[model samples]
Target: MNWLNKLERKFGRFAIHNLTMYLIGGYVIGYGIYYLMPNLLNWLTLEPGMILHGQVWRIVSWVLIPPSGNILTIIIMMMLYYSLGNALERTWGAFRYNVYIFSGILFTVIGAFILYFITGGFIGLGIFFSTYYINMSIFLAFAASYPDMELLLYFILPIKIKWMALVYAVMILYTMVRGNIAVRVAIVASLLNFVIFFFSSRNMKPYSPKERARKTKFKQQSRPHMTYPGGARHRCAVCGRTELDDPTLEFRFCSKCNGNYEYCQDHLFTHQHVK
Candidate 1:
C-alpha cells in the first residue's frame, strides 16, 4: 500500500475524475455502432492477429466494444456500475481506483496476447475480451467496501451486499468452470486486481474486526463535534440528526433511494424508501 502511496504522490495528477462517465460513454458509442454499422466493430476488437498484421489500433479500440446486451439491460448496467464505480473511487481515492481498473485492462490485454501465442496464432480471440468482467471486479470491490450496506432485491426485499458478493463470486466460478479457455483467461485476468488490491490492503490483518472497532471507538470519543454555518454537513433523512448532534455517527447515502437522500448508520437499512 505504501508503494501505492508513493505512486500516488508521483502520478496522481493524471488520475481521471468520474472515470465511470467515460466508460459508459464508450459503451454508448459501441452500442451506437452496433445498431448502425455493425461491421465496424470487427476492426475495434482486441484481436492480436490483427495487431500483428499492423492493425495496432485494435489494442485500444477493443475497450469500446461494449458488453453484449439489449438497450434496457445496457442502460441499467451502465447506471448501476456508474454509481458503484463512483463509490469505489471515493472510498479508495482516484489514484488507487485508477490503478485497480487500468491494471485489470492491462492484464486482460496481456492475457489475450499470451493466449494468442499459446494457440500458435491460429485463433483470434477478439470476441472474448470485453469490459464485462472488469466491471464485475468493480462490483466486487464495492461489495467488499460496504459489506453491511443493503440493497433492494428487485426494488423490494432488502439484502446485504456481502451475500450478493458471495453469489457473484459463485457465479464467476461457475462461468470459469463451464467456459472455454479464452473465457477463462479473460475472467481471471480481469479480476486479478481484486486479489492484489483488496488483499494487500491493511485490512488484511492489523485491522482485524476487534482492532478496527477499538480504533473507531478511540477516534469517536476523541473527535470534536463541529457545527456548520449554513447547515449540517450530514443529516439523516429519517432521524434528521447531523454530525453536530453526534460526530460518532457514520452517515451514508442509500444508493437504492430515488433521490439524493442520506441516512445515519442507525436508520440506513430500516428507513422507508422515498419512492
Candidate 2:
C-alpha cells in the first residue's frame, strides 16, 4: 500500500478525475459495439492467448465489454454504479479511487494470464474476463462506507444498504462454492481491492458523511496546533506522533493530500489520503 503513496507522489497529477463517468462512457461505447458490431467485441476480450500472439489491444479493450444484460437492466446498473463510484471518489479522492479501479482491472488481467498459463492456453476463454465484478465492487464499497444509507428496491421498497451488502456477500460465497475455476479467479481478483481498501479506509466506521465534513473542518482549523511533542516541525497526520516521540522515524509530506500533511515512516504509505 505504501507503493500507492509513492505512486501518488510520482504520478497523482495524471490520475483521472470523475473516473466513474469515463468507465460509464466506456460501457456506452461497449453497448454501441455490442449492438452494431457484435463480432468485433470478441476481438476485444481479455484473451491472454491472443495477447501472447500479439493482439495486445485486448488488455485495454476488454474493459469496454459491458456486463451482459437487457437494455433496461444495463441502464439501471450503470446509473446505480455511477452514483456509487462518485460517492467513493468523493470520499477516497480521485487519486485513490483511480488506484482502486485501475487496480481491479489490473488484477483481472493478471488473473486471466494466470489462468491461461495454468491451462496451457487450452481454454481460449477470453469471454470469461469482464468488468462485471469490478462494477460489483463499487456497490460493496459504497455499502461498507454508508451502511445505514437506504436505497429503493425496485424503486418502491426501502431497504438499508448494509442488508443489500450482506445479500451480496452470501451470493458471492455461493458462487465461490458452486462455480468453476474461472468464476473463482474473477471474483477474487476483481474484489481484492474491496478487501484491501475497505478495511484500510480512514477508520471511518462510526462517522457519517456530515460528521466527516465537520471533522475535516476541525482538522483544518487545528493546523497550527499540529506541531506538538517538543515542538517538532513534522508530525504524522495519522498517529500525531512527531520526531520527539521516536527519533528513528523518518517523516515525509504527502503530495497527494490537499494541504501540508506530513506522515511518519510507519504511516507514510498506509494513511488514508486527505483531499
Candidate 3:
C-alpha cells in the first residue's frame, strides 16, 4: 500500500489518537479566561489546594490550560500548533507522535507532583499546565527535518523554520530566567522532553515485516542499476542505493550476464547510457 494509506490505516479518526490536542486547547482557552475574568471556569471550580492534594483530574486539566490571555496571541499559538503538529503526526506516525507529546505532559506532571509534595500544598498548580515548551518541542521537531522550509510571516515575508525555532528557544530561555518558579520548571520540563526525544530517540517504530520485504525488493531490483565508488561498495551512481545503510542486502553484478562486474553492491553491473 502507498504511504498515505498506510498512515491513515494506522492513525485516522481515532478518538484517543487526537483527543489530547482538542482537550488541551479547549481547557486552556477556558481556564486562561478564568484567571483573567476571576468568575469564569465556575464549572471547574478549580482550587489550587485541591491540585496540591493530588487530584487526578489536574494531571489532565493541566495540559489544556493556556498561559496567555490575549485572544490574538492564543490564535497564533493555536494555528502554529495545529499546522506544525499535524505535519509531525504524519512524519512520526500516530503512536510515536502521541508518545512524544504525552511524554512531555507526563514530565510536567511529575515536576509539579514533586513540588507539591515537597511544599505541602503551598504552590500554584496552574503553572504546571504551561504548554509553550510542549509546543516548542513540536516545532523544533519540524525544524529538524525541514530546517529550510519557509512560512509566511504575518502573510508577508517568508521565514525559515530554524530561525523561528531559534527565536522561540531564546524567548523560552529568557522566560525561564525572568518568570516565576512554575514557569522555570515548565520550561525545564519541556526542554527535557525536546532533548531526550532528539538525541535519544528510541521511540521511532521499527519497520514492519511487509515494509522490510518491500524495501528489500526495492534494494535488489535497483542493485544492478548503477556503478559506485568502490567495486564492493559501489552503488548506482544514478539511484544512489548502497550497502551503506544495510550490509546484509545481497547484490549482483548483472541479472542477465554471468560475467562478474567491478561495480559496488548497489549497482554491480546495471547501467544504461542515455541517448
What does the lDDT come to for candidate 2? 0.86
Question: For each candidate, what is the lDDT?
Answer: 0.84, 0.86, 0.63
Scored against the true structure, residue 42 in model 3 reaches a CA lDDT of 32
lDDT of 1: 0.84
Clash number for each model: 0, 0, 7
lDDT by residue for model 2 (38-62), tens: 9999889899888988999999999
Candidate 1, residue 181: lDDT: 90
Measured by TM-score, the strongest candidate is 2
Task: Let me know the TM-score candidate 1 reaches against the reference structure.
Answer: 0.74
**In candidate 2, how many Å is residue 254 off?**
22
What stretches of model 1 exceed 4 Å from their correct place?
202-275
RMSD of 3: 10.9
Those runs of model 3 whose alpha carbons end farther than 4 Å from true positions after fitting are 1-15, 18-49, 52-54, 67-69, 118-120, 202-275
Candidate 2 C-alpha error for residue 116, in Å:
0.7
Better of 1 and 3 by TM-score: 1
lDDT of 3 at 85: 72
**lDDT, residue 202, candidate 2:** 56
